[model samples]
Target: MNITINTTVLPHLDPDESVAFYRDSLGFEVRSDVGSGTMRWIVVGPAAQPETSVLLAPPAADPGVTDEERRVIREMMAKGTYGWLLLAADDLDDTFQAVSAAGAEVVQEPTEQPYGARDCAFRDPAGNMIRIQERR
Candidate 1:
């Protein structure tokens, strides 16, 4: 058997805001935008990585989740403790500058990690942690 990763779901309070961050700020392309209302699923990925995408899905999209659960998700997302997406970039400094210029909430400036590689982090519109690592 053979398997490979395709899409990863990341929670979003507002699809439009998250889409703007990923598409406009990070320069990712919208692979697909499906569903409607609070169930919207916007898939975005780096233009070069057409095969992989992150689905910006609304927390209430899950029919199984209760209203209380959805409320909790919204609270956690606001606190920047809900979801995360780690990306690899060619130039850490350039990426950091561009994203900062685009008004993303900077969580950390570019810093070399003790483990190796320099990286930076930011909070998306919904407060999800988006970390970019320098590709070595």
Candidate 2:
């Protein structure tokens, strides 16, 4: 079986705010925005390639999630200990500058990683870190 990773839970999310960040700042397009409630699913990707979309899922309040779980999750986020969502970009500096101009909280200035990617990071309104990566 050929497999590829696609979706994951995304938090600290206001759809409008996130959309603005992705579209205006990063040049992604809204590929899909479907339904509401449990049926909801939104996908966005670079305008250059809409097929490779990122799923913007909300914080989990699914059947098994509970008060303790939610509390722990919120606290982790509040402490800024969450993992980042790395997005592809044509130019790291341009992406960084755009996001900064949009008033995103820049957590780190653009830098080259040992992995050979140039990137910069910020925290979304919901406290989730987002990174713009220009792959080598």
**Tens digits of lDDT, candidate 1, 94-135:** 999999999999999999889887899999988899999999
Instruction: Give the clashing pairs for model 1.
Output: none
Candidate whose TM-score is highest: 1
Task: List model 2 lDDT by residue over 4-117, tens digit each.
Answer: 655545663567776676677666788877766544456877666634667766666476999898788877776667545877677778777888998888898998888787
Which residue segments of model 1 deviate by more than 4 Å? none
Best by lDDT: 1
Model 2 CA deviation exceeding 4 Å by range = 35-40, 114-116
Cα miss at 50, model 1 (Å)? Answer: 0.9
